[model samples]
Target: VGSRCGAAEFACRVNAAVELLDAGAPAAEAARMLADRFDCSQRQARRYVDRAAGGGRVVVAAEETVVFTVKLPAPLAIRVRERARESGGTLSALVTRALTEFLVRGQARPRLW
Candidate 1:
C-alpha cells in the first residue's frame, strides 16, 4: 500500500505515472520508476498506474477531466449547440461524445487519401 497522502498529492503522482507510461515505459518499468521517484513502494506505483489507466475504483473527476479550447466556425458551433439541446445533453457532453466516436472510428478506418 502507498503511504497516506492527500487527494491532490495522489493525483499528482498518478499524473506522473501516466506521463511515464505515455512516454513508452513498460508498465512494470513505469511503476518501478515512479517508486524510485516518489520513494513509494512498487505496489503503490502500480496502483497509481492502474488509476491513471482508468482501472481504479475511485474516480477522481478533477484529475480525469481535461479542459480544452477549440475555435470553430460560428455556424458549426450554433449547429452543434442546437444538436446538444435536441439530445438533452450539455455542450461539453456533446463535444466529448462526438470526439470519442470520431477517434474510435478513425482507429478502425485508416485514411486512404
Candidate 2:
C-alpha cells in the first residue's frame, strides 16, 4: 500500500481541486486539470477532488470510457438484428457484447511507473 498523503500535499491538492471546481469545472475534468497542473497522476487528482467534494469517491471507473450513439449503417443494422434474433438476444445485448470484446482487446496494457 502507498503512504497516506502528508498534510502539506493533501492541503495543496485539496486547494487546487477547490479552485478548479470554483471555476465551474466538472469533477473529473477538474481533477485531470489539477493533476496536470500539479504534476500528479489523475488518480491522485481524483482523490483530492473527492476529499474537497464531501470526502467520497467522485468518479466511477466505467464513467471514464466513451459512449457512442448513432444510427448504424442500414445493412449493418439489419445484419446485427438478424444475428441477435438467431442468438435469442436483443440488438442492444449484441452491441454490448461486441463493445465489451472490442474494449478488452483494444485496451493498452498497464505501464510500470
Candidate 3:
C-alpha cells in the first residue's frame, strides 16, 4: 500500500499540489488528484494539502525515549546519516520510523533459512 516511499517522495507530491493550487485549482481538487494519483485515502491527501498550504515543509514530532547502541557497516551508516542530515530529521527518528514500518507489516518476507 506504499504508493509513495518517504518524505522525499511526499515532497515531490507536495510540489505538484502547489502547482495545482497556483493554477487556480481548489484545495479539494488538488487533494482529489493526490488521492487518485498516489492511491492514498482522501483524508490523507487532504492532510498533505494542508501541510503544503501551511507555508512550510511538513514536520514530524519528537518523542521521549531511551537510547540504544547499534553498529553497522561504515558505508550503510554513512548513507543513513547523510539521508537524515539532508532531510533535516534526527537519525533516531528516521531509523525508528523505518524499523517500525517494516515490523508492522505482517507480510514482511520470511527468510529461506
Candidate 4:
C-alpha cells in the first residue's frame, strides 16, 4: 500500500494499456508491463488491463494500509462505495477518517443500546 495514485497518472497507465492493445499486444503482455511499472500484483495489473480493455469506467484509489474486512449492511456498503466514487476517495480512507474522529477525537455521541 502507498499514497493514492494521482488521477493523471492512472489515466496515463490506462492510456498506455489502450495503446498496447491497439498495437496487437496480448493481454498478458499489457498486464505484465503494468505490474512491473507499478510494482503491483500480477492479478491487480491484470484487473487494470482487463477493465481498461473492456471500455468500462475505471477508477484508482491507493491507500496505505493492511487488509481489514468487516461485514456491513448492504445499503451501508453501497452508500460507502457510491460516496467513494463520487468523492474520488477510497472506502478505507473514509472509514479511517470516520473511525479516527469517532474513537480518537471523542466526537461520536453514545449510541442507544
Candidate 5:
C-alpha cells in the first residue's frame, strides 16, 4: 500500500515507469517491476504504462487499446487517407497491410538465387 505522498514523489514514480516502458518493457512487465521497486501493487505499474502510452511514446499491452499517431511524408499521408476513405478501410488497416507485406518480403529466402 502506498502511503500519502506529495507531488514530487508522484512525479518520480511516473518518471520511473515511463523510463522502464521506453526501454521496451512490456506493459505488464513494467507494472510488475515498478510495483516491486516502489513497494506498490501491479495496478500502479499498469497506471504508469497507460500514462506513457497515452503520451504516444510507448506501446501498451497487447490486451489494451492504443491509438498511434504517425506522421508520414505529406504526399504519402495524403494518399493513405484518400485510399482509406475511398476503400472504406481504416488507416490502421492500410498500415497493417503495408507492414505485413514488408515483413513477409524481408523474411523470404531465395532458393539459391
Candidate 6:
C-alpha cells in the first residue's frame, strides 16, 4: 500500500510486475524492479506482485492494443467473462472502459504542483 493511486496507474504497475515475474525474475527481484520503476516502496511493490500472483488480472492498455497473457484463477476469470457477457461487451472493451474511467477521474483532479 503506497500513496493512493487510481486504478489505471495501479494496474500498469501490476502489469509491469507481472511481466518481470513471467520473465522468470524472482519475486524479490521483481518487487525491486517495480519499486525502482514506479518510485514506490518495496513493500508496495511486493503487494502488487502478490496480488497478481493471487489471481488478480493484469491489464496493459496501449494505443494499438496488444494481447497480454494474464493468469487468473478460474472463478475470477469466469466472473469477468460473465460480466462482459452481461454488459454486451468484449472483455477488452470492459477492461478498457473501467481503466479509462479511472484514469479520467485521476486526470480531472486539480494537481497541487
Please name the candidate that would achieve the greatest lDDT relative to the true structure. 6
Candidate 3 has a TM-score of: 0.46
| Candidate 6 off by > 4 Å | 60-113
**Candidate 5 local lDDT, 1-113, one digit each (tens):** 86654445555676787788789988898889888988877887688667666543332223433577877899998998899777654576677778879889877966565
lDDT measured at residue 71 in model 3 versus the true structure, 0 to 100: 87
Best prediction by TM-score = 6
Q: Can you give the lDDT of residue 27 in candidate 5?
A: 85
What are the per-model numbers of colliding residue pairs? 0, 0, 0, 0, 0, 0
For model 3, residues 1-113, the per-residue Cα lDDT tens digits are 44555665677777777777778889999999998998888888887787678644544334545668998999999999999888766697789988889887845777666
TM-score per candidate, chains pooled: 0.47, 0.42, 0.46, 0.45, 0.45, 0.50
RMSD of 3: 12.8
lDDT of 5 at 70: 76
Task: Give the local distance difference test score of model 5.
Answer: 0.71
User: Ranking by lDDT, best first?
Assistant: 6, 1, 3, 4, 2, 5
C-alpha lDDT (0 to 100) for residue 48 of candidate 5: 61
lDDT of each: 0.79, 0.73, 0.77, 0.73, 0.71, 0.81
Which 10-residue window of candidate 5 scores lowest in summed lDDT?
56-65
Model 2 C-alpha lDDT per residue in residues 4-31, reported as the tens digit of each score: 7654566667877877777889999988
Stretches of candidate 2 off by over 4 Å are 1-5, 55-113
lDDT of 1 by residue, 44-110 (tens): 8898888767632232345455679999999999999999888754687689879989999999998
In the order shown, the candidates' Cα RMSDs to the true structure are 13.3, 16.2, 12.8, 8.5, 13.6, 13.9
Error of 6 at 29 (Å): 0.3
Superior by lDDT: candidate 4 or candidate 5: 4
Clashing pairs in 5: none
Runs of candidate 4 with Cα error greater than 4 angstroms are: 1-3, 56-113
